[model samples]
Target: MSSYLLILLLYVFDQAFGESQLKLVTVLYRHGDRSPVRAYPTDPYQESAWPQGFGQLTQEGMRQHFELGQFLRKRYTGFLSEPYTRYEIAVRSTDFDRTLMSAESNLAGLYPPNGTQVFYPGLNWQPIPIHTVPQDEERLLSFPLSNCPNYIRLMNETEKTAIFLNMTKTYGDFLEMVRNKTGLESTSIESIWSIHDTLFCEEKHGMTPPDWVTPEVMSTLQLLKNFGFQIMFGVYKREEKSRLQGGLLLDQIIRNFSAAASVNPSGPLKMIMYSAHDTTIVALQEALHVFNGVQPPYASCHIFELHQDNESFSVEMFYRNDSSVAEPYPLTLPGCAQRCPLQDFIRLTRSVIPTDWDKECTVNTHSSDTDVIIGLAVCGCVLLLLVMLLFIVLCRQSEPSIGYSHVINQSDDHS
Candidate 1:
């Protein structure tokens, strides 16, 4: 009787403790604060106004990412090794100065100099590798990828939709007001966002705004800015757009999770981090159907935690929008539990994941038209060659008796 009771206790303990274990974690975070990418034509702030020029990371940006790194260290205290190990964590960033710097800064906080690894006594920082591809060749994290012709067609079709047309009609006066105030020749919902961005950046950095930018004007600009985001990722055919945009990142994350789950004992990669832009986060969330339709704030992070329970794998997602918040908000995938099973998670997202990104981005008609043109050129070339040969034969035949008599006379003279 005692032996049976002991066996029952062991089974219950295994069921409770051995069921769930964290397998892997993947995090995608927006680069911290940055100078506005560009100033409007009429804006007082020019390229010379910014210390490092436009689109560069500010000092505060580095501090923000460093704090985020510390938070990650605390969150994964036991999961990640205390000392930085090259084999355990991999970091990748978009090929931009701000993103690369942010990743470097974050690493400073995550792995402070310790023991023999510290090369200098005074310096708390150590070198960590952050991988990146060139901007034009990048596909994983770059937003509104330029090479996608199908996405461009989708944007054009979206502009023709009734909803988009109504939006343009409603906002026509506001756009014109912006164009006149900014001294710009044309103004669209997207272009006007730059005005708001410049002002927002200036205000954040303690610069006084221009007198013409009233509270009401700022409000309108904010609304239009949000509308710009909607048009980019949400408004029309959102799912298809996501497959071509955010879905690319999602597919990579899932593959990483699946691979981690299959590894025996533990995976070599304990953490994978991405340093990217606000649009990168928005696109991924839009594809996951969890986007709140607001622009992700600077330094915002979206985390994916994979867990294994009783040999079954599951995925969990979290979003950290505010640094003040002690804990990140839990995000549940649509049509699945908060901790979604791995297979179900993959199945639900399969539609948004693209198989051949380049092929899908190419317009079908353009490809077929190219093939047709090549076919016609080949046929035309063959016909031209045949005609030239036939003309040469006819010329020889038309030379007639004079040519033959000349040849015979020459031969008799030689003999």
Candidate 2:
């Protein structure tokens, strides 16, 4: 019994205390706050009201990302080079005005121009390319991708579950009122989130929301918005949803670990930085089973650190949502330790990773189903017509029998 207790103690201590040399770091963060994408039909503050138009990053958002970048700079002081180098880090963003601008703002703070590399004496910033693909082509960083019809079908099925049905039943009246007020044709818990977002953004920008958007209304809308996130990533059939959605990003991140491990020391790609939306954060975390069940705040980040002690490698995760905290909170992967072995991490996460994304998204929509049924029906009608003709032609025996032999290949040629 004493030996058993000792073993348990050692196992617990081992899981808790093995911080080591950091080999690689990957940071994914939500783009800073911006204006709402668009306003409801009845909204007084339309797209024209915003200076740079809807969905553009605001001055505050720029400050938020810049500060976040500085926070990262200070946090990884000795690990990262003082000057920016393309070999050391790669920055990727979804192709959106706000996200792209946020990445630029972040880079401004992360790597300010200095030394001989400075192009102009007065300019403190250097131009670093932030890579992006078109929205339709983006798979690595975007969340809740629309290309998967099976995912849509899954979501539709999920909506029929008791929890979602109860939510709808509970909020039916409230949703109706919102639809009427916003002049929207219809409203659901999922759609009402946009109303909350518009009001929240206006409030964040120091504009008073209309009286219809009361404190209570905003609070309830916030619940629905969070619930909507849950539905996309986790309210039910969570792992199945992850396989279709978040697992793609997770797979890319895992492969990045292998890439980072293979790179030569002379030109190491030490970090990968991704700037995207709040949904991006939620989806990745959901894949990892570490989501905190809320909308990740603007500029919030999730960090993946690949650590090495001699030949063995381990993975560590940290989440930074609170600006007040000096250090981000560590996240332990379920069924693994805080400093989880790379192999174990991969093994544990294998269930969620998709083997064939396109195949998984492909529903059993037999393209030839209708054609086959129609063909069978037509064949039956022809057979019935032939029987009627045979009855009529029986009176003219020999001619009809010869015609039947011509029609029946079995009689003409046995082979």
Candidate 3:
């Protein structure tokens, strides 16, 4: 009797002493399925074949995000209130029709207008602002950024690695056949993904591939495509490449986590959402050192949940690339557990999160420096031509031209 009483007291004490609370959630997801961006010259279908033309989101895409939003609503039932509050959540997306619509669709499911939020009786949707910037100006969430010359050099270096060289050698003849058959000028490891993408998109939409696209051919193409994704961030010197590519996003996630932790129960910010692309997911998972090496499928999502337990904080991550699974797969940082202490999580990821992206992205190679010099030289030459034209105009204006002063006739001047 005394033992049972002690056990009950201990249980009560444990329950009353500390509480674990959900503080914040960050969700980064790829836009749902889209129409093929384009087709090869020799392809059977062209831009006229797809609905609303190239690279637009499909109805299926809308349904995917809507379901995902429903999943989130169920997952965070008690944490997120029924009606949406602008103060509780913030959303951002890449400036594209597909992503913007995906975010809108996701929000439609996550926060359907209820009671006070319902402005209309007929419609269940409410207008929520999703912020975006022009594509060219975007630094965050863009992958394999072309503006970074140093990153280009890294790709150059990566190609020389043994794995890359072996793949190139093995696929050389196949690539030649692809180039000849598809009317591409050339097909190499770098550009094979485009062909694969066109084929994959077609197959997904119930369109059969050409006669040449056997199952074995499709398998090989997918292998090469996955390798291409690896090349962008993980083939060689993965961490450094991530520092320049995906680390920017990871840095933001940490910042938001820190912000949530500092304010604790007082902060109104409960969730942050980013609607992006497959490459965005790849870059981020690679930075986290938790990528499974498979291409993130459409509607794939990465989740970061910040928890406050008593006086300490922790972060848990999940990847939901497979819709078949009832729950998202738990993700752990390379050197940490599934529920990593906030300080440990930050420390483990310190190397990948860049301190100065521009400085780190700078290359001191002679060729790159020469390119810079050449660019400067071209600018100087253009400037000099402009100055000479201006001087000539000023001289003619100040001391009138001989022809201007005399008004010489054409015959008189010739004579």
Model 3 ranges with Cα > 4 A deviation: 263-266, 365-415
Off by over 4 Å in 1: 1-18, 263-267, 365-415
- Lowest lDDT sum, 10 consecutive residues, model 2, at 398-407
TM-score of each: 0.86, 0.86, 0.86
Looking at model 3, how many pairs of residues clash? Answer: 0
Whole-model lDDT, candidate 2? 0.89
Could you tally the backbone clashes for each prediction?
Answer: 1, 0, 0
Model 3 lowest lDDT segment of ten: 399-408
What residue runs in model 2 are displaced by over 4 Å at the alpha carbon? 1-19, 262-267, 365-415
Put down candidate 1 lDDT per residue, 260-377, tens digits, no spaces: 8774544578999999998899889988999987888888999999998976999999999999999999999999999999999999999899999988888787778999999999
Model 1 is weakest, by summed lDDT over 10 consecutive residues, at 399-408
Query: In candidate 2, which residue pairs clash?
Result: none
Per-residue lDDT value at 358 in model 1: 85
Computed on alpha carbons, the lDDT of every model, listed in order, comes to: 0.90, 0.89, 0.90
Predicted structure 1, TM vs. truth = 0.86
lDDT of 3 by residue, 1-415 (tens): 9999999999888777666789999999999988888899999999899977989999999999998999999999899987898899999999999999999999999998988788989898999999999999889877877788778888999999999999999999999988888999988888888999899989999997889999998899999989999889997999989999999999999998988888444468889999999999999999998888888988999999999887789999999988889999999998888999999999999999999888878886677789999999999999999999999999888984556355669998889
What local lDDT does model 2 show for residue 329?
95
Superposition TM-score, candidate 2 onto the true structure: 0.86
